[model samples]
Target chain A: MSQQLAVGIDIGGTNTVFGIVDRRGNILYDGKMSTKAHGDITSFLNELKERLDVLIDKVGGKDNIRGIGVGAPNGNYYTGTIDYAPNLRWRGIIPLANLLQDYFDVPAVLTNDANAAAIGEMTYGAARGMKDFITITLGTGVGSGIVANGQLIYGHDGFAGELGHCIVIPGGRVHAGTGMRGSLESYASATGVMLTALEFMDSRPEQDSMLRHTPRELVDSKVIFEAAKQGDPLAIEVYEYTGMVLGAALANFVMFSSPEAIVLFGGLTKAGDMIMRPVRHHMEINLLPIFQNKVKLVFSELKESDAAILGASALAWEMKTDQKAETPQP
Target chain B: MSQQLAVGIDIGGTNTVFGIVDRRGNILYDGKMSTKAHGDITSFLNELKERLDVLIDKVGGKDNIRGIGVGAPNGNYYTGTIDYAPNLRWRGIIPLANLLQDYFDVPAVLTNDANAAAIGEMTYGAARGMKDFITITLGTGVGSGIVANGQLIYGHDGFAGELGHCIVIPGGRVHAGTGMRGSLESYASATGVMLTALEFMDSRPEQDSMLRHTPRELVDSKVIFEAAKQGDPLAIEVYEYTGMVLGAALANFVMFSSPEAIVLFGGLTKAGDMIMRPVRHHMEINLLPIFQNKVKLVFSELKESDAAILGASALAWEMKTDQKAETPQP
Candidate 1:
């Protein structure tokens, strides 16, 4: 018998990364496609199916492929639909999982990208042995996937883990898209860091900083992190403020679920101790005494490039287990 | 065969209520003892056992009793202990459950009062058929119990559902006991409502209301509720502000767990529509569009007097089921 494998696909706004992964979480083969190039869902699936077929053949044909798991924006696990993902061209609910299953003649599952990251962490990263923990992905927008009692919390609507949108500062910073003020996403995301940097620079007229030299449009989380590393006071302040907000929000998350650990993933974590110190400080300061020193805040151990694919593939393996449970053998 | 029964105990600061409950949740007989009357745990237990034996004899006796369940402040379910309950006379961790088991020679379990209420709601009240819901007890202090996927969330440490401590208004009201500022318990509890009314009165010296006539020390949640009934502007404003804070916290809770419903119990909820209207309105206003108007904020249907006993009895039933699972007969 051939070694069983699963296909993992991570659908992003700009690009989609897909890979054939073994049971041990190794990506045997990987591929990418331009997400924006295909205007419709059908075209996107056609391109994906065509590319995946070649990869499947290389890995000993379709029989060896156990299933396909997809991680997409606003993905709903229960319905297997992607609903109104702002970054994606798709306007409404798209049955991407069903489409993939039909095209490949294999079972397919889908979940939000953040949830996929959480599953990835559980399967092979920071949350490997933990039954209760939250995975926070601080990227273009903040996203979260909560795991409790060794199971991902899908909730009643299968959209339980939207921690980013939880308002950290009521009536404070207005979110660009949601228009909701003081949301964690509005203050802690990569975009949020840039916005905070811009605001800080604008407030201080006499302070000389590397960020001030760059054009407003060119300034991003990367530039701000670089400026902080070079000891720019304004850049340092930006991270401090961002971490404070993120920490307070994390404390709230801790109080809610009482997770054993909270794993931080994505771009913001790249700042290392610069961002982590304040987050740790404020989180402890805000937490109740019972929870104060109990929760471990750690970064994702999964390789960033492989995390999404691994997470999606973990979902595929999960489906195989579910199928086995449902069908008993004599 | 005699119908199996369980002894349910609700241990409060001033008084302790105990009853023999059947499988269908009916309290066959009930009695109370003054908790503060006894200075030591042994004395308290002796008195409680002496009184309870008479009640047990009225029924079918000890053979008919399946188990015992106790609900108290700061109760730890895993260890069956009550740790440093500020309101109670007990100084340190009291192994109340183990003590009961030793005394009665039957199985006994323990949990926090709020968790008991949640179990009660699930077993005999509003949350009877609901798999995902939160029970918020707004008494002297705020407390909560969360149920997800048809089980109470005890988290990694068996103390997961501590929603009262979650900060709603950062740096807002300071909790008298926890010393934590801006906690949900500080703003949404009955005591919080009294404090809010008192603060409002102090701020607006020019405003005339029925509360002005009542001595400052005399004002309580019941007094404020009576004043709100008469449509006093100051009293009414107090409920509105309390509701606003509660609503915002409820919105955050909804975002965190996405429970199907949030059941409100205890004294503060008795303000009825005066509190519920603003809570529902603000909860919707603060929630993201997807979660807006989806969560049901309902008052618990269990009789306030019977809820604690019923909840504890449910724990006894749960223990019985667990025992059966552990020891399967051939």
Candidate 2:
């Protein structure tokens, strides 16, 4: 019998990446396309289908394929819809999973990218065998997935884990996407880091920093990381402030769920100890005595380049397992 | 066979209430004793057993009893221990459930008072047939119990749902117990309300208020409630401020679990719309657009006088159901 495969699709603002993965976490075949180029959902679906057909044929068509799993912004697992993703061009709710399932002639599942990352971590990364842990994706914006008793907390609605939006510095900084002040995403994400660097440089006129010389458009998380690594005091302080905010938020999460560990992922993690050090410090300091020094804070073990596709793929595998449990054996 | 009954015990700082209850929420027999009068655990246990035996006899004794359930401060559900409860005379972890089981020759289950309250609400109160909800107990101190997907979030360490300790204002107010600053409990409890009233009076020395005429010792939640009802501006502002802080914290929690409802219980709920109006207003304002009006924030339906005992009793029923699942019938 041919080996069963699942298709994983990761929809980002700029690009979309899809991969055909086997049950064992191997990416057998992969492709990419421009998300912004397809102005409408129909055009995006058609382009995705046309590109995926060649890969599906190579892997013995739809019969050998188990299902498709999609990781998208503001994705809803229960309804399998993308409900008004701020970063995406799609307005209102799009029945993306239904569209995918119909086009592929197979079942498809969908959840927010962070949730997908959490499942990926549980299946094949740092959170392996840890029943209660949280996966945080610190990218352009912060996203999170909370797991308790080995099941993702989907809550009453499908949008349970929105840690980024949890008000940390109540009435502090306004987010461009949410318009809410003092959210974790305002200071913890890559964009937040850049904003902090600019704010610090502006606030302290006499502070000598490499960031001051760099063009505003050119400065990003990577540049800040490099500057911090080179011992720029201003760049280092930016991470210290960011980590402090992130850590305090994490401490609140710890008290809420008492997870065994909190796994960090995405672009902001590249700062390594620069962010991790203060995050560890502030998180422990803010925690109640019982929860202090207990939760393991670590980075994702999955290769960042492939983590998205793998995370999305893990959902398909889970869906297949659920289906088997529902259907009685002959 | 005689109808099955369970024993429920609620251990408070001042008093310990115990009752025999049937599955249908009927209080068959009940009694109370001074929790502090018995200075030690052994003495407390002996007095408790002696008082409970008479109630058991009235209900046909041992054979008819299903099990025992207990609710107390610092209670650990998994270990059946009460670890270092500040209010109680007990200094360290007390194996209350194991002791009860040995003395009564029946199973005994234990959880924190708030968790027990949540179970009670689900079993026989306003949260009946609801799968997702949170119960916030606003007594001397704030306490919370979180239920998601029909199960309490025990977390990895059986210490989940400590929403009271979740920081609302970073470095804002100091908690007498945990010494943590800006925790929800520090601002949302009955004690918090009293503290707010005192602070308001102190800050506005010339402001005409009835509270100024009343002695400091006479000030409490009930007094504040009465003052607010009588249209005292200072007292009314106290509720508004407390509710604003609480409402913001509730919004953070709503973002975490997206619970269908948030049930308020204990002393503070007596203030009614005085507190509820600001809480509803601030909670809605802080929430992201998707989560704004979806959650139903209501008062718990359980009668406060019998709630403690009823909540503990509900745990016994749940324990029996769990045991039945584990051990198959002939």
Candidate 3:
């Protein structure tokens, strides 16, 4: 817990991961525990606190901790609060950072998991060498973190990078964030891919797809991706459709941000070519007249823990460095 | 002749508008001339040259003119060129600013029209008091100028702020600009609105709609707005659809740039409430959780001439003043 080591916590819908990371992006000690299934907000924090106490005790105490950084669903960096994240049962606004700060007796910060990924990319992942780019996490839902002019655009508050919910199909399907129908998340997200696969199978039963042998509950995007790699039309179609949506949405992103590159992260993106080819093809086709030839789509090259932890740490690191630099050396 | 006035030219697909203006956002002289359908690029410049000669003569010879500021499609501020506007029938890059500089024997500058409008708004219009905002023009296509931290976001190659072509409705419609289908332009642009309106009227063939009498050639969003105001369900639907698309796109924009406001311009947006109501309703709803209670969406208050001309002039002013400020003067 020395001030040289910062605590990095990645609070997910299912698990809460905590670590002591140094300025060099090294995790010295780490621990994890199950999140409250009942969505009991205080109970969840109490459990995390108990685990953190063990880690702190091993490191000689809380006074040694410089700061705490949290990567969470619906987390806001500027406000340090978590809004309604359905995956977690917590309701209303939770002062996540403040809660951690109070229990740990150290400065703490919290931001969306995706924003943390972007920062992680900038500091330790595929986008490490870049100053301006977007990091997209193709997870349960599509989450993106944007870096422009070497800073995260927290946008008046901290909800600037909700890329998944932008309407990709205006009247297509009901999306979660916007309550609008047919967002990119509706068609390209992992769940969306599974839905497409099910529909494809139901609509075209004659297709001898490998996915036909997979159980319904286990019929997620990974099986579809594997089937596509082995040349299954139905599975390939799922990737194609997902890529098309991603490409179209990415093209729009290019017009707005003009970032140097776009890096994809998370499980769904692990399909790589199965996901990228269509995205690139469609992205190139839909980009602005001038932006057509520029901009590259690539995959994130960071460990999951690295992106989330580093990104969360970036929030505190950037803030601390900026503050320190601005303190006016007498 | 004097530094007080410069000739500002904005060349669009159909018309080439030229104006003589001073330091203030005032047009002392202005004229509109057709770009002359399909001709040599030099001929267009010659025609402009001849016009400038007459103006110089009117101002007691060439010494009375300061320089020139040109706003053209595909104009690159970094390169001082107009690089192929498809509708202009100019298929290659042309050193537009250099050509004018050579002709007038003084300084000249060039940039894309959207950027010009941004400068115009920043220096003299609704955004005069703001430093971070975006100006979106919903004409035949969607055009945008981004102002971030008090400067335009021209990325490494100077091609940034292509807001209209960003994907709002992925796979919704095949659109211009990169041939990516279903962009913001395809749904929210004037051309996009026309497509949506036609689709709207067709969707409700049996409805009591005023669009029944609207001529195809003269048909536009205005007719739809007037009808929507008069309680036409179909027309209201059109506006609602357009605004929702705009709002959804704006939410993404807010995430990327975190601008103070988004200022709407151009013909399609003139429908005012017809366009804004939906955009606001949808944008506010889908906004990043943090931006939910904050962020403002507004319309431009600058006349085209005032904003465009001023924007063009401001480009030149930025260049010349930047040079002056950098020069080691005794």
Candidate 4:
């Protein structure tokens, strides 16, 4: 059988999603499993290989598969390892690409999920035909991928483009994950919205709202979005604040690279105009006259998981045939 | 005579400097002229042409010259024009490259001064042999040039790498030039140092210092440096604060591109360890663990004007022979 499909894996904090995709961005087969269920990297690898084998057989066996690509938090493109990923059960460096390639008998590649999303955007999404753009993922954690001169800025360490970690507040909110003070991720992510919602409702006890009744643990970006839809002023303020910080950060990014557009992705983007209006307004006001009003700000058309899967899959197309047999072990 | 020399011009607000340079980076002949000595740009061009002709003749005529390269405020590499340079006598867009090429009958290239410094550093200074690094000029104003994958990131509008304008403090300080709040330039440039020194001394009226004795008009970064060297606590605090903000901004730039080193240029760097200590401290504290302590922060080895001249000259090497005749008029 001709090699016509690539396996794409998106490793998330809670769940691991994988798909077999063709060249045209079609997901021929896909499935999900608990990322932490197996506890150890070895057990997780065993289960992944077992599950993937069944999908491989269904898709006319291994010969029909082109290669594999994995997108994980803290993934390093140059080393093909996941280094010190905060959310992962396994600590330190894991040579995931080597393991996956050895198990599947095909070439494998890995990159931080945001970088994968950027490539996916360039190849199949909003950034198509554009040589310069940025993809910002606003989810549980903010992630970013910067593309300039038609290539991802992997930097010297393959860890460039961490816009989420860039300080926006300057000694303001403390980030729980990285212990970073006033990072864009700390203020603009879904978790940030929840934190903001809780603080706003708690501080303004007299400002009666539906969110005031919701348990603090149960309150998330979705609850805030729902209340916001119902014209909750406090909730609306949360989106505005989030967009303000995000917009300021976006302006900073704009000055750094002056990309043609900034593609926003993930959960918080669902807030839509509630977030974008302020983002656009702040970004414009902060920019120099030469850079004002030129960048296109758009939403990612691909579903969150699908975009990650497709983006990871896009990497496999670059694998050379000789890459399959050469392995760099951890 | 062989075409082994390039004419380099550094256009500044007060004075314009030009040099006839050999391929190995030696300035064979150099001269300076008052940029505003001529009221209009047309007169300035005529004077510049007449002066350059003498230098060209000294170097065996125009036939020996490879091309011309210019570094100026608001220079656009793509359009070869100076667009709305606030400091320059000429306003709006001036097609300097086209005019120079037409006069000298050779190709002419232009980029912002900071970018020229970057190319110069890469070719003949501290950044030599490094593929990825940033050159930051902290002069009367802050300017930057970013190099990644061995190419300057000009962005979509030929105006990328404006690290100076990136908001580091987020509404903390108002920039005089652009009126933007809390920009890196507002807090880190030489002008910023003067402002900080004044604020520091005024905020503590009881504190007796050398700066208090100097007239406010005469007090500048040099005065502050002298005061700082004398162990004046208030002046030292000003540098500490400047370094703190500059370091935080540097951390942001590091996270953006992950360059191997950040080369510091211009007047403020002359303060040496007085500023570098706090900059390194604040930058390390602000960065995530993965990025901490990896980037080398060093001062530019080239003299201020020479670096700009050499950097502008470097652009001439890239001009294709055929590029000389095809002029794009502004």
Candidate 5:
């Protein structure tokens, strides 16, 4: 038989990436489309289909493709819909999985991006062989996927793991759009880092720093990280503050779930020990005696470019395995 | 086939209650012994065995018993040991389950009291047929058991659920013995309620109230609850503050796991809407829009007297089923 493969699709606001991946997590063929270029859901689906068809053909054919899996914003595993994802231009819930399955004539599954990352970590990355762990994605906003008892927790509404929104500071930083204050997302996300940098600049107007040279609009997480690397005191303080908030939140999460490890994923982890050192310290200091020195804090092992695709594809493999378990021999 | 029964034991600092329970969760016979009177682990075990033997005999015989399950302070499910339970006179790890099994010639399991309560809630209380829910015990201290995906979450270390120690207020309400600050237990437990009442009194000495009639030493959770019921403003404010702190913590817990409901058990729930109204309000206010209306906050339906016995018994039933699954049938 031809090598079995699954199609992995990572849907983002800017671009949509699809790849043909082998069972071992190798992306054999890859394709991409501008998500914004498609004015409507129909056009987006058509473009995705055309790209996937070409990739499938290159990978031996659609017959060799076992199924398709998607990771999208606000994706629901139970209903297979993207429910009111704010970043997406789509007006309402989109039955993206069913649409993909209809086009490809194969089983399809979908979950939110963080859940996909968690599955990726569990199946082929840092969390391999671990029964309980949390994969925290620190990106444009904070998101989390919780794994307990070797199963990804999709609570009653398939939206169980939204650890980002857990209030960290209790009326501290307020998100402009969501009105959520003191959330871990408000302090730990890349946006949070940028906001912290801006607050520092405002608080200490007399202090000379490299961040002041850059325009307010241009100063982002990258600029702050670069400044901190060059030993800029203000930027260094931003990381310290960010990591302090993050570490405290992580300590609470450790107490809540007692995961073997909390794997950090996405952009903010790029700060490495600059952020991790303080996080580790605060987490240790804040933990209960029984929980202290037990939970591991580590970074995700998945390659950044491949992680999203791999995570999405892992869902397809899981679905294929579940189907086999349910079927009976003649 | 003869009816299957199991022994359920709740080991507290003052008393150790053991019961013979049928498969359907009925307590056929019950007995209790003064735990403090035993003075040592060996004597405690001897006394426990003697009492349990009498109860087991009344329930039919040893042949009718499937196994034993014990719930106690600091009980470790994986090791079947009570590790460093400060309230107990035992100085070190006590292999309670193994000791019981050796004397009874049957399998034995042990877990923390809160975990047992969670299993009981799942099996025979408000959480029946529900796959995801949290049982929060608000007695002298706050305790929790988190159930996800139809399985009790025993994390990598077999201590997954400890929501009580999750810090709600940073550098606040330090526990005298543990030195743990800002923990949910420090604010939401019966002790926390008493402390809050004391703080209110200290801060507002000029305010006329019913609480003043009771001496400062006499103030406790029960006294405060009764005073609140009588419409004392200061006492009423104490419950509001306690509920606010608790509700905020509960909101965070809801965000962490996104359980279908949070079942409150033990003394504080006795305050009813006086406490529940503020808790519900604060919990709703603090939650994200997506999480706000979806999760339920309900009081546990299990009877206080039977809950521990039922919970421990549920563990035995679970073990019996697990054993059946492992054994090969003839």
Candidate 6:
């Protein structure tokens, strides 16, 4: 099975996605299953193993299966485990890859989904040739993958590149996960976008904005984008405000990584220019003269739905390549 | 004069300072001269060169010198030039290292002052053992120096670490230099801090704050710090607001470099915990749970006056060490 094929798996709080991917970023086979209903991680692994076995059979009897790569919410590359992940109600260190490898008798590796996305972008998405860049997902929550010097920074404990949490405003707003006020996520996530629109509605109750017509809980970004597309003022401001916060956060990242570009990916970002224009405007207005025209903001080419899986798969390939390169192969 | 001691020159907008430094980060001798009150930069270089010869002879004489490291406002390491610098009234690139090297009969290297500070931190200051960290200075303007994967990122045009220009707010308020709006500098730099104080003052004209005693044009951070120390609510809020902005920017940086720490230097940082506490609180509030309790936001150990000289000397020492390390032995 050496150098034959690798399984790329991206595990989330709600769903588990695994794909048989080759060295060239091609998906040979794939499957989806729910990540254990409770904290029963072992059960989740067992289910994954069963599904992988089926995929192996579908791909001609598993003769070419070499290893597996897993991208999880809180996977730690250095420790070869996942720490307390709030989403899955998991605590302590879970030797996820090792446990799964025991069942399949093959090499297994893992990394955080953010780092995986970074590797995916480097290998196949918007930042393909750039040495430095950041990829952000404005999904249920915001996710950031930072790439510097053409390599993902795992930091001292493989817990680096947490871009979504940085506060854009201190004492200015509130976020669900963090107790602090004015985090970038507070202003720019899917929920954050709605909050912004909701706050705008609250501020101008007398104004005849379309958001006033929408219920608070029923209010979502898709509806907001639809309104913006149809010339809704408040809807447009939400995207602009999101872009402003995102742009500010990104400018700070640009300072640190000096990335040539930043790729935006996520469900909220499907609005495209409605989002990018404000982010760019703020970035331009905020950047110093030297970085004025040097960096660019781009959209990820990978499908928003499949990007996580592709990114996770890329991480596995990258880890294997690094190990092979450094192991003094005979 | 072939082996005369290497010169470490620190050039600024107002004055030019040069010193003969050895490979050990020690300044053997030094002197300064006015950098021409009016037009042209050649006069400054010629005067600097003449003074350097005098200092060099008084120390170890000409043969002891080997090279020169020029730290300037817009010096470029790769090109060995100083491009246009707005503060210096210079508007074109000059082969500064070449011009000095030929004159001193020694190799001359060049880099921006902030970069020199970063290298200085790497060689002789707080960041000596670290490979990833960011250094921010709150001075006339916000400036940053970045070290990634143990090497400084000069970026595409040696402009990679420009943190001052990234917009923190887009079209919300405050103008920034980089054609953007609401940059970190708009609310964090010394000037930025004062701007906030001024705005705060406008809404509280009758307050008996110590800040009211100081004239507007003559106002500086020292006055604000003194007022805060004297229990001035306005001054205290100014400091808090400044920290809020800085914390947000640092959080932004956390997402990108994921540095172990961010070191703050310069005058305004004299506020100490008044600034650090809020920034830490804000940063914590904004960071993702995975990145929590990991990143350190601390102060720089280097003094403002001695920092430039020490950093410049350290920069030379670094170049000397690397060049010596790379040279073929007999």
Q: Which candidate is the best by lDDT?
A: 2
Q: Per-residue lDDT tens digits of candidate 1, residues A1-330?
A: 453899999999999999999988899999999999989999998999899899999988888988888899988887888998889998888988778878997778888999999998988889988889999999998989998878788777777888999888878899998898899999999999999988888888778899988998999999999999999989998999999999999998888778999999999999999999999999999988888899999999999999989999888877744442113111
Docking class of 1: medium
Among all windows of 10 consecutive residues in model 4 chain B, the one with the lowest summed lDDT is: B321-330
lDDT of 3 by residue, B1-330 (tens): 256666778888887877776677777777777785638788887787777677666656656556677778888776777787776877798877777877777677777899888887887677886767888988777788987656776654567788876766544688655566666788887677778888877777777677778876666767776777788778788878888878888877886767777888888766777678788888887764556756767778778556666677666655653332113111
Interface RMSD for model 3 amounts to 2.6
The candidate scoring highest on TM-score is: 5
Clashing pairs in 2: none
Ten contiguous residues minimizing lDDT sum, candidate 2 chain B: B321-330
DockQ of 5: 0.77
DockQ of each: 0.70, 0.77, 0.40, 0.78, 0.77, 0.39
Which residue segments of model 1 deviate by more than 4 Å? A1-3, A320-330, B1-3, B320-330
Off by more than 4 A, model 4: A1-4, A53-66, A318-330, B1-3, B58-64, B319-330
True contacts kept of each: 0.61, 0.78, 0.55, 0.79, 0.73, 0.53
Best by DockQ: 4
Chain A TM-score, each candidate: 0.95, 0.94, 0.89, 0.94, 0.95, 0.93
Q: Is candidate 4 or candidate 5 better by DockQ?
A: 4
Per-residue lDDT tens digits of candidate 2, residues A65-151? Answer: 787888999888888889998888889999888888788877888989999999999988999988899999899889999988788
Better of 1 and 4 by lDDT: 4
Question: What's the candidate order when arranged by decreasing lDDT?
Answer: 2, 4, 1, 5, 3, 6
TM-score of chain B of each: 0.94, 0.94, 0.90, 0.95, 0.95, 0.90
Clashes of each: 0, 0, 16, 0, 0, 22
For candidate 6, the per-residue lDDT at A185 reads 76
Candidate 4 residue-wise lDDT, A25-83, digit = tens: 88989999899886788899888999989999999999998889889999998789999
How accurate locally, in lDDT, is each candidate?
0.87, 0.89, 0.75, 0.88, 0.87, 0.74
